[model samples]
Target: MTENGAQLFARLETRPCLKDIEPQLFPEGGGPNHGEVVELYGTEGTGKTEMLYHLLCRCVLPVATGGLEVDVVFVDTDYSLDMLRLVSILESRLNAGSSSSAESDEAALRLCLSRLLVVHCSSSSQLLLTLHFLETSLSSRPGLALLLIDSISAFYWLDRCEGGASAIRQEEKLRKCAELLGRLLSDYRITVFTTCHAIKKVYNGPSSGSGYDRPYLCRPWQRLVTHRLLCSRQETNSVAPSAGGSEEQSRRQVFTVHCTSSGSRTKAYRSSSFCVTDGGVKFI
Candidate 1:
């Protein structure tokens, strides 16, 4: 039976999308819904991946302890899955939120860690294969709500060079991968989040302006992106003190999220600020 637009949206809206992280970014009673793809793009060292880890931790932590308690599947394409780092952040968050005993906290942390399934892929082909086989796991894990890929453009330059004077083959490979990912999103009720490099615009002038950084994924995957979150860094003013001390300055990231939905207003923009400390992404 084919579901109509209203019915589909009703179902999608029931699921959550980083609601705990920043509920204000979403509509009333809604976050990143199921079957939607969200892209986080930024230059190197912009804390894009760190932000994703924060979202993942929110998903896997128990609801009783201030977490969504949903399962997450994280596919690491750039060797960016730092388990120790994630655990550190998780421990900090759990400790801060929970008044449970030490043994109970440790048990909850272990349970949350088990819910996050991590996969590593070194190449694009391997990525495709990983997505293809993920269906079984997705089916088995009914609580799963988010699927993440750390920088889907991990092989951008390599794939371009491998094309050898032709870009069609490279585009086709990415297109096929996007198709598979889309099918998975449609078949299951999960929100997809992926990071991509920001392609610098080659404009004739000093490169300091808005809308200069564009997503680098191929056209197919680009079309799948329902929400685009641009991450950038801003240095704190010397007059303002950081968490460390009154004399210390720190850098924070600003995320500007743009919704691609047709009904959205022209200037409907949402922004959030956060910093990545040893604990993890701290929303400010």
Candidate 2:
């Protein structure tokens, strides 16, 4: 049976992390609806992966404890999934309880981590194969809500270098990957968050002549991105209080702007401010 918009909305899962950071990013204060693809693009060290980990923590945590309590599939292409960092954030959330029993806190943390499944893919071929294997898992696990790829363009330069004289061959592989992702979105009913690199400037180099940066990905992948979050770090001298000593002040403020396109018009919500700390992403 085919479901209409209301039926689909009823079935859609909630993402507490997005709500916490920026409720305006989603329609009617709901987080990314089912089958939506979001791309988080930025230059290096813009807290992109950290933001993803925060979202992952929120997905796996219990709904009773202010989380969605759903399963997550994290594809770490850059091999940057910091288990320790994720655990720290999870622990902070658990400990913030109002005199909750110690055993309950420990149990909740265990349950949250258990629901998360991380897969590491070092090469583009491995990433493709990993997604293929995930099909069976996705079908079997109804609790799964999100599939996250840390830096979808992890192999972009590598693929280009290997292609040598033929850009067509390089693009062909990327097109196949995008097709698979689109199929997964339609077939599995899951929200996706993938990170992309900015192409307008070198990592942290000064902005070019026009001083604009854009998300860089193949056309096929671009088509799959329904919503785009542009992340950037702004240099700042202001100090933010830290859980640790004052020595750990915030060095930079991170901004994320949510953009969605309809027909030929594009609408972007105001940017949100956050800072990365040892604990996790702190919205400011």
lDDT (C-alpha, whole model) for all candidates:
0.75, 0.74
What would the per-residue lDDT of candidate 1 be over residues 1-284, giving only the tens digit for each residue? 45655655564555554533446445553455567777888877777898889888878988876788888899999997888999998999889856889999899899999888889998888998998888878665667778999979888888888777877876767778999988988877678888887767655556646544655567888778777777777666435666776666544445434433322424345676776778887767
Worst 10 residues of 1 by lDDT: 258-267
Which digits, one per residue and each the tens of the lDDT, describe model 2 over residues 1-284? 45655444444433213433235445455455567778887778887898888778777877666777888999999988888889889988778754888897888788898898889998888888988988877766767778999979999988888878887777766778889988987766788888887666445556544333565567888887777777777777766677775655546665555455332335546466777777788877
**Candidate 2: misplaced stretches above 4 Å?**
1-27, 201-212, 239-266
Question: Number of the top candidate by TM-score?
Answer: 1
Q: Candidate 2 local accuracy as lDDT?
A: 0.74
TM-score for model 2? 0.82
- Worst lDDT run of 10 residues, candidate 2, spans 13-22
How many clashing residue pairs appear in each of the predictions shown?
0, 0
Candidate 1, position 198, lDDT? 75
TM-score result, candidate 1: 0.83
Model 1: residues with Cα > 4 Å off, grouped in runs: 1-21, 203-211, 238-267
User: What is the lDDT for 175 in model 1?
Assistant: 78
Error in Å for residue 108 of model 1: 0.6
| Residue 108 lDDT in candidate 1 | 85
